[model samples]
Target: MLEAARTTPTALWNDSSDLSELKQSIAFGGVGATCNPVIAYSTIKKHLDVWRPRIEAIAAANPTWGESQIGWQAVRDMSVEAAALLKPIFDEHNGRNGRLSVQTDPRFHRDAKALADQAVEFHGLADNIVVKIPATKVGIEAIEDATYRGVSINVTVSFSVPQAVQAGEAIERGLVRREAEGHDVSRMGPVVTLMVGRIDDWLKHVVARDKLFVDPSALEWAGVAAIKRAYEVFQARGLRSRVLSAAFRNVLQWSELIGGDLVVSPPFKWQEIINASGYDVVEKINEPVHEHYLEELNRIPDFRKLYEVDGMTIEEFEDFGPTRKTLRQFLEADADLDALVRDILIPAP
Candidate 1:
């Protein structure tokens, strides 16, 4: 476990940030941490006793702002605090690790400049901040612009080989543009996340809804297969951006991608469970997904769209089944955050 945490260039990450957690998980071998708007909302709700007063102060100080503005201010403050705790480690890693990823508003998904502009602002909040832009078409454009402006990016809302590859290519283009202008790209560490579990979840939903006869176990490997193929594509093309595995469901979410230069981030709850399990971490990244499981899983058209390199086009990404599902869920999280702030700003009678 120590070897898995320290030796491998694969950055072990905890998807949540807290004071003790920042120390504990990093000491347990995490070099990076990530937060989406959903996690940010959850963090505020988790510590209402501590943040409620400050939130009230924010509302008072920003009388011109709505719930969305007040809520996002909370996220900004939380992210900066987490980044402070990780700064030393970030310095130690020379920018490869010790990053706190703050996501842009999901509501801005259709607007490239809104996403990129927010990303640049968040990137200014902390030196170690890696901003997450969704993998939608506009997001890809936003990501490239943000990167050219020197924002280290973490691509989110991605679930397939095509999305990962496209995002990676976008980052590469941005890097090259920066280099052309004599900018330093050395300290920038950008990663494209392949949310393995979410893809698996969507496939499972499809299997049950359609009453398809896929082998039960085949569903488990759907995400693993997509990531494995994506990793291969990344390697074969020499893309500078790394592939990150997120949304852990089973141990394979963390276990199977052990050795590759991958970022395996489980949420804080599962991080404790995984750290306690004492599972032997070995090099399994290069190992191919079982051919039988692949064959069974490919029975689903969605799986093929995810598993194949040409599965979806840039134009088609926003409408893809899993993409739509995740975007809806993330947007709902923003709405929930707004409602949370609204209740405090204007107490319900």
Candidate 2:
């Protein structure tokens, strides 16, 4: 399965600013990339000399623009460069591979119209660019609107099976609408990101604080189990949206889901570990969640909803574990980038 996956392309989850790293990832079977504010900010900071002129030019043209706006413009420029690097691969794969995702601002996560409009703007950055949308309630609506308008989207911040279902539905709805209007749906690309690691990270903290008697092994498998179950949901629904296995914590998390239709975006270090391990069999790791793990997870009211794909309302999906925390983290990173931009654009006189 690994070899077969090799024949196809995989995506890397990192900043696109580093040309050497991006090329290395492509050489190691990475066909695409994902970018966020953290990456955009870090890249700008690292290559101040390279980006300083661009920011200065923008500042001169829009003197009335604030620091945040100027800073985000730099990020947009970086995103365009990254997309250009992957354009050939995207063309070669005919839109399946060689796609780049740039996330919308977290502040508009709950505004569907804003997200859709922003998505269209990001799409204009490059042909290979896929606007990243958070899978919040409004975000799903935005996904539908963007898809309807022929914009590709990468749905992020999704943790639950129901959330995944909603995103898939939105994508499908948009595709159908496009099809009705005589637009081809073959080139449309959308991926629902199912975050791993963070789920177990949250569970571990809960177990320690609550002094729960849950088995340690069970905790270890929580993240993987949730992801596999979500994959099962995707498979069962036959949704067009692909599953992106993201935020991996270890090699097992990378190795476990090799044979499925999902695309795994392992971090740079984790990718190195997988390459070093030299494991080469693509087998299904989509086994049922361990009975003990499920039982223990059921003890927590919040986790119980996450453990199973059903029984959670749309409202519950937004308030569930990992969802709120992930959004908060994104917001914090956005603020950090905003501050970094402010300092760069308007230095202390």
Candidate 3:
């Protein structure tokens, strides 16, 4: 699989905070992991026995910290532990793989300075950590500022070619700035995370509601098509930032993007399916966007504008279909975590 004609893709675990699961994933060929608010909340709830002592220690030290701060601290500790486990892989790959992502509070997604500050703090947790920043209008600026400050970043919530292109350009701009300041550009790491599955899910609902007809075959391939288009744009731009294909929903999405210079963070179920298939040969399935589907999608002006362009103004990128929805989801997750911490956990402060 590694010696095939196409690029050998790296596998990254999609969840964080389970040591046993993390070890299992690593043994099953995963080199990294991603941490999000929902995962963090789940970890806290399920592993209370494991995290209780640490949470108590944090509360004891802070004395007056609120639920939000304490919740994030727990998240930081779990992410750091995950990063420690992946550090050797990171070292071996020269900082390209073995990344453990720690996401910032989504409430701060619109604040560039706060996001940058949170990223810097997360970077301080471990050397193998990549701070996950939302691909919002201010997020691009935050990515640029964080990269310029020598921080590795994973620009999350990207759903279109324009968002991915803007993210890559932001990282490039930051690297250039860092180089001007005498920092080594080779050490900086940035990944633009293009979400699959969700695009198709959204389009499915839209088609169902509006009763606009399109080829069902083309609808099934919408997610993969979006990813392929994003990959093409990334290649044409010649940017240094890597592309991380995330939010996969099925086996076909996994098999189709087999050989690419991208990181795939498929959920545990999909990973199991791939492992059971015993697939050893790598095949390149980079098909062009389906014409009929593209035409159908173009009926929605926003979808067409974003799909056709490689780049867009920051305003357009923020208002793009999945970006807004994904950010709200993250914020809701953060809020849910806060509620859980306040209502259930009684850390002595």
Count backbone clashes in candidate 2.
1
Q: Write the per-residue lDDT of candidate 3 for residues 153-242, one digit (tens) a residue.
A: 998887777788888889999999999988886755678887777777777766777787676666666677767777777888788887
**Candidate no. 1 TM-score:** 0.98
Q: Where is the poorest 10-residue window by lDDT in model 3?
A: 1-10
The positional error of residue 172 in candidate 2, measured at the CA in angstroms, is 1.0
Cα misplacement distance, residue 91 of candidate 3 (Å): 0.9
The residue-level lDDT of candidate 3 at 345 comes to: 56
Lowest summed lDDT over 10 consecutive residues: which window, candidate 1? Answer: 1-10
Task: Give per-residue CA lDDT, model 2, range 303-335, as digits (tens).
Answer: 666657674777776677678888888788778
lDDT of each: 0.89, 0.76, 0.76
Candidate 2 RMSD to the real structure: 2.3
The numbered model that scores best in lDDT is 1
- Shift in Å, residue 25, candidate 2: 0.8
What value of lDDT does candidate 3 attain over all alpha carbons?
A: 0.76
lDDT of 1 at 183: 100
* lDDT-best of 1 and 3: 1
Q: Per-residue lDDT of 94-151 in model 1, one digit per residue for the tens?
A: 9988899999999999999999999999999999999999998999999999999999
Clashing pairs in 1: none
